[model samples]
Target: MAEKLFGTDGIRGTVNKGAIRPDMFLRFGEALGYTLRKAGDRPVVVIGRDTRASGLILQSAIVSGLLNAGADVALVDVLPTPALGWLTVQNGAAAGLMITASHNPFHDNGVKVFGPAGYKLSGAQQDEIEAIIQDPGFDCTVPAERFGRVVDAEFDVSSYADFAVRTAGPDVSLSGLKVVIDAANGAGVSAAEPVFRSLGAEVIMLADVPDGVNINTKCGALHPEGLSEVVRANSANVGIAFDGDADRILVVDENGEVADGDQIMGAIAIDAKAQGRLAGDTVVATIMSNLGLEGALSREGIKLERTKVGDRYVVERLREGGFSIGGEQSGHVVLADHVTTGDAIIAAIAVLSIMVREGKKASEVLSVFEPVPQLLENVRYQSDDPLSAETVKARIESVSENLGDSGRVVVRKSGTEPLIRVMVEAYEREYAERAVNEIIAEILKADGQ
Candidate 1:
């Protein structure tokens, strides 16, 4: 049978809409509970959510379904997705659920499932759950008194903060630097401030207050203009912005310039290499990573391996190749030795620690690699037709040949949207812009309007 609900991340949509409605989420919980019970006995499932207004309602529906299927539920309120993943494995639970739309707008919501290993559910496991959800013969009912009880658990954000501080090693501390943290009014607001304060940095916070409807609304990594202003206003050493789920982070230098994932990864990689901690002298990144990053690492005799776009794919490559570091350009960094998933707070701490130890400015410390000129344009389509039209394909090929060794082009259809993303990277800004525009024009033509 073909899968219908799950995406590359999990089940997601505009809340109260197709497949993400309350009834569907309830059914999903039941299917997940049943699958876990069949694998073991009276399995425990830990659940967490971001600050989206729909989170509580969805949490209630999911908990009801899990309890009816005889699975004990631990409701961890208002925690980051990675924290839930950590708690799931730490408590030896059978699975975990996080109610979040991640970087999506507040109007959207999602349910992400993590297996016993604390990683996202694999394709086979997700398929099994979908099968159970679809089967007419599968029973989702449970008798009264047999229904599992829900327990409200206090999640200690301080524990994660302590862990992040410790990971910077004994020799590092941000004792005197002034820093600003923008929490995107999402999950990190609770922990990020304390963590920086504990490390002795002067902390200024913005967008940390979540009104349930404000999470990721013109703030956080997707919209960092406010963060830039905050940094400039305070003359802070640096600024950090976390997404709605707090699994990713982007940096802004004291000069109010945005520093993306490539810059962050390059900074960390150089430090690791110097400390002899970068395993096999290699770092794993997605294909979307700027070519400048690869060139920078090459200068230091370090290798860059490209994986697919997902952080999971990057992590899988890291493990398979025995590399210690990997991340995406979107700022989802994974230090396998530290945490199971991306922890934005932890990542920022690591970067700041480097600054402290080196006795350098945040801009100086983070500017380990220079980025090439890159441009990304998304072309929306009227229909969900395939983007491999002869005209579009020919244009891409021609652009690639024209750029030759001086640059590269990547044209891909977005996984979650009916759009084609045309990206180009070149040594010259004008060339990159022209190359991307050519491909975009062709894609627009292929859309038949």
Candidate 2:
């Protein structure tokens, strides 16, 4: 069997390791270039990267491969993932690639491919590229005369910032809002501060200094505890934290309470429904979304559709249903009306707009629903197929039967990492904790951990 390269997001792993190495990235770029060349002659492929030191090396190698395979390259230098996607569509490129591991540590890196419309690649497209990369006999060389040229397109980042500010509409302004933005020391540092300040916001930057290795060390959406504290210390109206690539966000309220994607989506859905802007009166989220979100939307006469655990799946379902809003609990909110992928800055703008419109504190508007007690535990595994173990399966089944309809258990392997995510939600915190602990014990035992 062939090795799988694409994950729920994209091709990601530790930098200089496995398929993330420069040599493999060069071939990966060749595969992508070949695929694009088949669609158009000397197709343009827009490329950008986050603030990791490895980004430059990987970018050089990939650009060499793309040029070698007869694809013109528009290098955007350092830009957020969403900005790169937006630029790809604006530049009429055949495809786009953003090099960053998102919320992962700086030593990690990735390549997220976007189609012409700035959406993620479909399964069929991924397969085509993977086949070319895995085939040892595949030829990637092209005639020197047919080689493509490279162009400096770094100035286009401002265009993306303008588009992001426009997502909140012309009437929206952040004049009185004091925003604490945690840029994860990544690509967002370049755009987030400028966009917010342009709208008259008093922007306080946090974790904004990127020293290559400090991208997500103790900051960003994944580690927003510090963001919450800073918000309180500064008495800011709201705090927003972006991951390494600035694709997703987690907000902190005025009182320093962290708001995850579910809360953010709920607030957006409620506001959209009130404004009659919510298409189909629906919000699409992942199965990992809390039942509280469903109940809250239900009360508002809105339908909540659940997909698998990826933001891509959420976007797919939203498009299928023509829903205007969707995202994951992990801070990947895709506002289809504004973006094709999870654009953290745009989503933050939406939330801020809501606060401005309602004339309320971030604490008042962000907590749209009271989340039910939920516990998610990630268990690492070195063995293969721990879910297949009899003890683990039995424990899962037994827990399900015992919890019945009042609670639920969701256990699945992480697509991007070697671990199992076990989530349990119930009406009571103790019950949820106990159920999660039991499942973890069984999983660890099964994996011989």
Candidate 3:
């Protein structure tokens, strides 16, 4: 393992190479085992993975490292990422590891590590683990007598399902509603339908079958176009899609209208405020959230707190401010009263619960704002820092000035992907689109693309 192996999420990259190789995965687990030992004598590590061709090899390799390092292991094979964290907290394990690439294609994979408290490892903690993994003299195995053991974790789908059920509250019901759940052929395949069915909805499933290579292939939250057609065809009351690890969600309405995370947050925030469950009258979102969401929350007297573009950062701000709700535009909604991370299934339940409680369709209940016209485009570059170029800065400044108070321009590098994201929001679509295109052109010119 090299320095800064962990990305915005965790140690993710193309499998069999770079940070996600078998050897590196083992080292990550070994380092984690040592870290866990600092907390308890008999440290236990719980492992879960989504459906992918590389998941099996990676899981076994990680288990080997954990056992070699004198840590007991429980394997919840093919479970969602949040479920692993929940299991870690439920079993009181020292640490939790989830193998998934989330919305990435099957060729890539990752390992997300959580602490005993079920929250992600802090930045300092991640740095420490990386240091341990990189040290040439660090041992991967302990003495034979101190070696740990591994076992198959009892797959209790109900525990997580129960959490989702409870998130909707006792009075909420989906008795007569028709729902469609698109699993993206990943970890949510086993859990999504069960959770919805237990709530009394007639559920329709899409992309629920996982063939390893097909996970997240034109399905799930990242690409819900297909789900929209199904929802419209079936005339279902709502459609819900999840990423590979099931931590993020995207919603589709009966008329095939899709709502991004910002819309979801806006709707949920309004509902929480009406019910007086929105603690401190605040909502947390990442910097990538739509500007309209902030306006909508403001109209309801709910404050919108924006952190850097990550759900972990959003959750951190929520915890620091004693807030109860936070999320990202990518659909990573974290309800503090529910699970630690963004449990997409629970988020779906919460949104649907609002629909039932209001006796309205999803489009009606989730229509919390008239979003500002926005355009976001990514430009790939082979430079150390593409956005620092004089020409790029000039273009960004020019666009910001042109939009004036009615628009905004945000240009930044993606933490996980290799591109600079140019986001322009304006009162009109033409302005936003033009500004974004101009920025992309400037970036490409700078990169000599």
Candidate 4:
């Protein structure tokens, strides 16, 4: 039997390899179609992709599978994952498929599914789809008359821009501010340009041209140094860098300092509390979030809840706890009251709104809390079986104890790689680095490296 392919987020790997191969994608689509058909009749699936060269091939294979399974497909050419999610529900589709690997390198790609409500499929739902994919007797055929039809919809840059503007409200506008945006040459390129321009800000764009291979080429959130340099060179008020799919955003202040998701959440949380708009006066973040962020929110009498690393988990916690805001430290902010998922465009608007309303620089507005030093290292193992090794567990426990209250340590196997992530955060950079290094050394020793 083929190995199970789905990861914590979705099936992701180097294009044409492992779970990301064309055949696998075709099978995945067929399985998805079968699952949706079992749930109801004549299900519709909306599809979108990033500007990757391999995206077209994967999309074609997926569409073929969906069509072969007797479903209708709506092709929304080159859109962000969140937009595809919103469009899925808006068009009453049974499922939405976004073709992009998010922050992964250019050679990699991924597929993430959304339910009819524009939310990601639950763990059980993914498992069911996987089961169907692995079933030998599952029907992969479709009737000629019932084959899916694909309709090309004009990309609605205005609709998303309008939604972002409305979310910011008419009272808030960045009339005289100058802002620089690095779209990572991915899904947000076209939409972010118009949205910022419409909001009355002088917009400067970098990495906005997507030639398929250039998406996230050392330019987006994963590499904000370029954006920071641009911000400093142009003396812009602020800078926003978005990942490949534009679901997450990293902000660069006027001083060209990077303000990560935790800082942004702190700023927004404090402001929301002051305005009495923070539901339950609480915010949700991942365990990877900085300790300073928790302290900052706590000082305001707002509760902070930590979940696992994925934004899906963060969103789940937010929904279950009735919280209005939550996100990952990587800038995947979810304003659940406004959008169903992490939206870089919406988060950018929120950050810009704070600047416009306060008449402050992005640096001034975003620096709501001082972040502690954090170090993260990913150690690849020779064999995947070693993650559950006894020595690794003992090392993790020992490191956790050493961290105590002065610092934090997290060591876990990567859901998508044959590696373990070693993360340490503390008030002092040296201590965090040493803690992470020691843990990595232990993992290396166990691996006989």
Candidate 5:
């Protein structure tokens, strides 16, 4: 059987489980290093991780494997995922790896590898590494003389922060902005606050304390309710909530109403187009993006091109067309003009610049479009081929037909988790909710839930 380690993004799972254990991570590192060594001589691989308690163990093992394979290792400690990608290009290294599970809890950790150009490794690159790891006879041992040096590079983290600051452009400043930053207590624990404060914003930090276990506990992008409450209570002008790795974000308005990627992209796209900065006069998003966003962009004569789910694919589509803006509804916005990957801090700063330029309120600027009623539900199953089941297919097709032109239904297996997702969109709120619930119920029944 083929090595089924990589998913939509990278290898991710609960620590101590199948593909996330130390042994596996070590092998992953060795395989990655072994592969890179073939492409060039004296390959350097930079490493970073999040605040998850398991990250240290995994990082150490991976680093060891890389060293054994004769690849130089540079450790930046804990930082955002985008920083890893950015530093890959900055250091002129062969590759970069970030040990994180993103929005998943601390017990979960994974590795995302980036190529020299600061983008996620292409499918062919990942396939080569996977093949190496799966080969039972591959050699990972190396003589001591070939052992690569390891550097504790604190300056790399500082450079990424500096990069974030410069991403806001030379003319923009947040001098009077009172920004509430919810760092998710993961990688953002070290990133978001400094950038905002340095930009002259009065920062009220929330969920910034990462005690290993508290990375995403009711904090960050996944659970923005706490951020909303705090934003409302503090009367802060805006709230920025980052995922564990800080590659994505969700902005909370002053009223504590959370604005997702759809709203954020809507506002940014409008502003970029008005400033004549939007490349190709287009924006890219995933199939999961809100229908309202498509309509809103249409009104402005900007095309809303979509790809499959995953910010990696969005970034791929963005680069292919030279589009300047692209992202997911989950708030993984990619300003291709700046960072190669999604940088929540950079996206927030860009939006803050827009706010300053327009002299508008956070709510007024963020609420760029009125969203149509949409409902999504997840159904967990023990089998990997649930989507292939006849009952599940029939129900999904039935729902899709019911929604017709006035509505739509999206049913797909999650790339990161072992769950099937059903999303219903319609003009009527009750209809959308009912359709999603019914399909979820049917799937649960089919799976014997």
Candidate 6:
């Protein structure tokens, strides 16, 4: 097992390799169960997973570990990540474990742990779990008489759909809208249709069949081109595409234009501000959010608080500042009023509700601002500190100085993967592209590539 298990989201990697192996998942579950059992007698832990073939192996291993450790388990099969967290809180479970790799391909998988309040576990909490897993003398199994039970809780998923529908409020309805949803053949396959159809929208589904190996294959929020084409072909009012775990989304407008998280966050902020529902008149976003979002929100007397690149960081800032909304450029939006984590469905419902209330087309409502030209590239590396190289530092400094005020330069290592992400935003696309290439060249040179 790898010494570390958690990443920016959770422990994720290719199936049966590294920390993603079934044995590692079992150890993680045993550790978590041990902790939960220590906290409460016969503590219940809710579990869910996306539709991946490997999920069967990982789930069974973890459930066995949890049961052996005397932790009761409730399995809500094939549910979205956000729903797992919500259910954890609703059931007062000691914790919730969601097996998914979010937007990653089906070959990869992960396990995300949610605390009692439905928030991701804290770093300290993760450390404790790791310690338990790594301890050689620690026993994970309980006496036979102390073993806990496992139950299938599939029916509880409908309650989550009901809760998501209520996020749009009691009076809102999508009476005349034709909505197309691309579920990415992931966890949202079974959840998206019912929610939208209940709201009176004419619903069409794509990528909704989960054959266990097709999730995020040229579909979902990561690839919106196919969705855009379908939206235009069907004359749909809007198109929504969700990632593997359905915790994030990307939207397609009537003009076949795709709107990313920055645009969506800006529109939601403006709407919430107007409705007096925006707490602190602030929207939290990662540094990866487009500069145009900042400028647009500023025009509306709203503040955009920037955090490090992670929805967890954004949510932390939101909770600390009592803000109502926050998210990433990747469509992982957190509407604090409804969810403890990023929930694509709730965020989509919010956008749809705005359209219904304003009686505006998706293009008109979604295209809230013109984004500044931005270029992003990711470079994988094996070095321990590629950015520490003098040449790379110099190039970063030079680019930032050149793009001061009018543009921005962000270069950082990804927390979830061994890659450096380089993003350059400027008034002109060509300039942003050139600047990003220059930095990547320096990075490559520093890595001896």
Question: Relative to the true structure, how large is the alpha-carbon lDDT of every model?
Answer: 0.85, 0.91, 0.86, 0.86, 0.88, 0.90
Clashes of each: 0, 0, 0, 0, 0, 0
Model 2 RMSD in Å is: 1.2
Per-residue CA lDDT of model 6 for 1-449, tens digit only, reads 54577778878888877667888778888888888887798989898999999998999999989998999999888888889989998988889999998888889988899998999987788889888887857997799999989965544678899999988899999989999999999999868999999999999899999899999999999888999999999999999999999999899998889999998998899999998999999999999999889989999999999998888889889999999999999999999988999998999999999999999998889888898898889999977788999889999999899888989999999877788999999998888999999999999888888
lDDT of 1 by residue, 124-174 (tens): 888888887778578976778778787654444556567677887777778
Descending-lDDT candidate ranking: 2, 6, 5, 3, 4, 1
The number of the candidate with the highest lDDT is 2
RMSD (Å) of each candidate, 1 decimal: 1.9, 1.2, 1.6, 1.5, 1.3, 1.4
lDDT of 3 by residue, 1-449 (tens): 24468877888788876566898878877888888777777788888899999999998888888888889998777777888888888887888889998899999988898988899988999989899888959875678898888855554556766776777778887899999999999999878888888899999999999999999999999899999999999989999999999999999999999998989888888998998999999999977888889988998999998888878898788888989999998899898887889988988988988888888999998788888888888887887776778999999999898888997888988777678888988999987888888899989888878
C-alpha lDDT of residue 21 in model 6:
80
Q: lDDT of candidate 5 vs native? A: 0.88
By summed lDDT, the worst window of 10 consecutive residues in model 5 runs over 149-158
State the lDDT at 2 in candidate 2: 68
Candidate 5 Cα outliers beyond 4 Å, as residue runs: 152-155
Displacement of residue 400 (Cα, Å) in model 6 is 1.0
Candidate 2 per-residue lDDT, tens place, 128-223, comes to 888999997899768999998997664489999998988878898899889999999999987999899998899999998899999988899989
Identify the runs in model 3 with alpha carbons over 4 angstroms from their true place: 1-3, 152-155
Residues 1-449, model 5: lDDT tens digits? 65488888888888887766798888888898888888886799999999999889999999888998989999888999998898888888889999999988788889998998989988888888888888869996678898888965544877989989998888888999889999989898777778888899999999988899999898899999999998889888999999999999999999999999999998999998998999999999998888999999999999999899999999999989999999999999999998888889889998898888889989999977899888888888875576777888888898888878988888888887888888999999898988888888777877777
Against the true structure, candidate 5 reaches a TM-score of 0.97
Any residue pairs clashing in model 3, and if so which? Answer: none
